[model samples]
Target: MLQAKMKNGQLITLIHLSKKEVEEIKSRGEEFYCPECSQPVLVKSGIKVISHFAHFAEKNCSLAENGEGAYHESGKIQLYNWLKKQRYEVQLEAFIPSIVQRPDILLTLYDKKIAIEYQCAQVPIEIIQNRNRGYLNAGIIPIWILGANKFIRISQNRFKLTPFLTQFLHQFSSSYPLLLLYFCPITSQFVKIQNIILTGSGQAFGSLSVKKLYHSAFPSLFSVDNYHEALTYRYWKREKEAFRQNVRGKLYGEELAWHKWLYERGTHYEYLPSSIHLPVKDQYRMKLPPWNWQSRLLMDILHPLSKGHVFSIHKAKYSLKKYYSPSVHFPLIHSHGEPILQYLHLLERLGYLTSISDTHFRKQMIFPFYTNVEEAVKGDRRLLEVLESKI
Candidate 1:
């Protein structure tokens, strides 16, 4: 509601006018209304909040629900100004007639159109997906930047990533890691959560970099390579130990069933080898936890095969139907296949499997099973050393 249409059909932006000029307009009894809906709106000039036009309380406008208090408005205005300063063509609260959706800010570059959504409030994942679909159909790339105030900081390089928040993550390219973007209007800082590695369903360790809006440009957001490998390894070691120690705790749903399945195979969950549940960047996209899917792969597919026996991707995907998530579109990120493939590749890199073809892989070494948790931890250390060398 930063820009409203005057009665004469001229656009008036309250933020551009001085306080004295805004008072003069109000004293002259000028009438302004919403630019999109063309409904009567009143200019609100308050001491605490930014000055803007608001629709009547009884009127329901599409933008009203997505609209929020001054914090959200200020952030939208700031982002719009920042993009404009970069010399990109920008529009505020642009209503795409074809999609009937209004993005907070729309930008048109040389040959590409992008929609920037500054989300300051929590919304359903379904709504987010729907908006993404609409943008894709219209040939516009949608970008979501969350409010930094909502970021739950757990440690220096870790944060609690809720299922709801994961829907907003973006991946610019295949080589780049999945990233979360956050902006703080209060401090004019942008926090990019880069190189994310999920330690659990709701927990992840990553590098958090905060820079002023003016200090970083648009392209800088796409290139994020800085990370702490030693810190990540230490964190993963701690998580592996916690997983082994917490095995006897309460379980539910697929987790409980998976444990029972392991028992039927004459093996305990804690005795599973370290190779299972190893780190994979795309593990977050799976329907089941790493332990569930990884254990299933070993117990059902890889362990039973004789030396030199090969398995195809189709066989792997079908055998692991229980771990497949419902088909969901992840914007800008191409999940190569089931996340288990990444784990298989890691095993390949460790000299256990060899890639014979695009769809088939041959088993080289027999599955390694540790006798107890102590041995499993040591195995993980060796795995970490190999992984570090590649990194």
Candidate 2:
């Protein structure tokens, strides 16, 4: 906790308090109380840790349970002071009485109140959801900024997307690209992952941007960046090959069922069509990985259809509802449309299906199948070439 209330009902912060002021404050013997619980708090100063308030260990306050460490405490103050310099009305560790929630930094933009939570520690998804619900009920928008230590960068544009990290993904508007924000106190760097494509259950590729916190402004966080289609497909080629290795590694669970289903279809993993696991921009809506549901649709739905046979996405979605994650699951995204619709469009481009209507498509040609890995790799490259041209 960085803020405490004086006996005179005045709120004071140790964010910019000097050593002399700290000593003077301790000498005065004035009592300082917590703003959240209204309990008496002690001023703590150390050689390494930032000077701040700490509740008594015996106290049983909800805020005391948070235990915001030195990393979170310093980062919160840094962001608060950074935002304050831009002339934006920013409040540090602002406690909202109506919601019984305290955001690390609360910024007011006219009528809109945005609660910025700088979460350095890993917390349960339910805690995050409950807090967000409380803030939204009070008509306050909540933005969570992760500590850069959680940013799992596997390559230049590639990263691991764990279930915990997905909650931070934000899509401000329909026209804006989805992104997540990351800040590191030690490095003083801010990382923005924009235009992310969810390729697997836990893997994603995105346009990554890193800049010093001092070099950035508040509005810059929402700035849209161009999607690198060439770069995506270039790296996707490697991921496509990795997909083959991954399937062989999995021996049980839903993947085993998928393999058994494929076996019944008179085909095996290596011999399956190259079109199975291609990228869908809106794939986050799917509960399963891109390969699983995409393979299911390719085999069960399209493979049996004769030339000119029409299929509707609506019916496909209903029949395969279990594969889809409900729209409500993505509270931060404004609109992702449909992964199936995008997949259909991709098939249309690849000559597997022809458009009949917005909801319907006609099968034009049978999906290509390769006998071996060498042939499959070539087919994948051809499809990627088509994608690159379209991009």
Candidate 3:
């Protein structure tokens, strides 16, 4: 939307133009056309708004629902300037003909090409996926940097990570950890959240760090090695306590259904063993909440087996196939490993199970239910002591 083609097939960008030049463009009486659709467009420039070209309201273009506000415009310019000052090969609103798309800022570093998209508004998930697929298919990596307004921070270790927000999580390379980036144009501050681990719907545990734009470089995003994984464990400990207390309130949907199942088995939330509702590093890929599926596996399979009986990971996952979300749920995560193994390994460390092989686990000690909430809290405290040491 920033670059348009003249009638003579010459491309013009308004990013580095002066107000006098913009006034002359308005008086030049020359026609400008959109690069993507080749349709006539009008130049919009004023004191309040940034200089750019817009397609007519009646026309439909893929780039129409993009970078509309001066906030979006100003942020892209700052980021482009930052990269340019670092002596990196960067372009503003670079259009790719093969993909029929234009990224906000495209940076070509070394042998790799990265398309940086500065997003300030909410859009459909399918649109995000389609754009990512297009960039990936063209051998380019797409990094989506969300606006500061899009980030809802609950605390130092807590984040309200809705599905729309999670769609923007970026894994720069296979060796790097997962992270989400946010920039506040007004404040000139950058917020980086690394080692993001989803615990439940719309909630996660991560290490959040903030830095000014001028003090940071491109490699800082990937190489910042210092973070407190202990904070993640602390957040999980609090969530487990809250999970135990939720049964005192009115339950609905999956929670209500799970309560009914517990009633038939003569068990309640406070009576559940410490193993239930524990955290897994990749709970985002599962359709059911941790308690529902973990409880089901314990009651239906693991709890009924003899102490020496062994179970295969294949058989366990097959029995609870409906609880797992497809691998496509998390497009940004490159390495897809089963989350159940983490839970099993945790149980193994806590003396409930033993690893017989890479794919099989043998039952070691049977799990026990608590008689009261206080006793359950004690069990959690004891279990988390070992869990924290291992983490």
Q: Specify the highest-lDDT model's number.
A: 2
- Tens-place lDDT per residue, model 1, 17-115, is 888888888798888888778898888886777888888785667666667678888888888889888888999877788888889899998899899
Please give the ranking of all candidate structures by TM-score, highest first, separated by commas: 3, 2, 1
Against the hidden reference, what TM-scores do the models get?
0.89, 0.93, 0.93
Strongest candidate by TM-score: 3
Candidate order by decreasing lDDT:
2, 3, 1
Task: Indicate whether candidate 1 or candidate 2 has the larger TM-score.
Answer: 2
Task: Please give, for residues 1-391, the per-residue lDDT of candidate 2 as tens digits.
Answer: 8889999989998867997798789788889999888999998886787989898776777668776688888788889989989999998888898988889899999999999999887888778778878988899988989988788888898898877788778888877777999999998889999988887758799999999999999988888987766877887888887776554764778878988988888887777787888888777778788888988888888888998899888876776688877766667777867888888888888888888777788999988787888788777878888887876
Better of 2 and 3 by TM-score: 3
**TM-score result, candidate 2:** 0.93
Better candidate number, 2 or 3, judged by lDDT? 2
Candidate 3 on 278-387: residue-level lDDT in tens? 87876776777788888998888899999999999887888789888776656666776677877788789788898888889999999899999988887787777778
lDDT for 310 in candidate 1 is: 88
Candidate 2 lDDT trough over 10 residues, lowest sum: 242-251
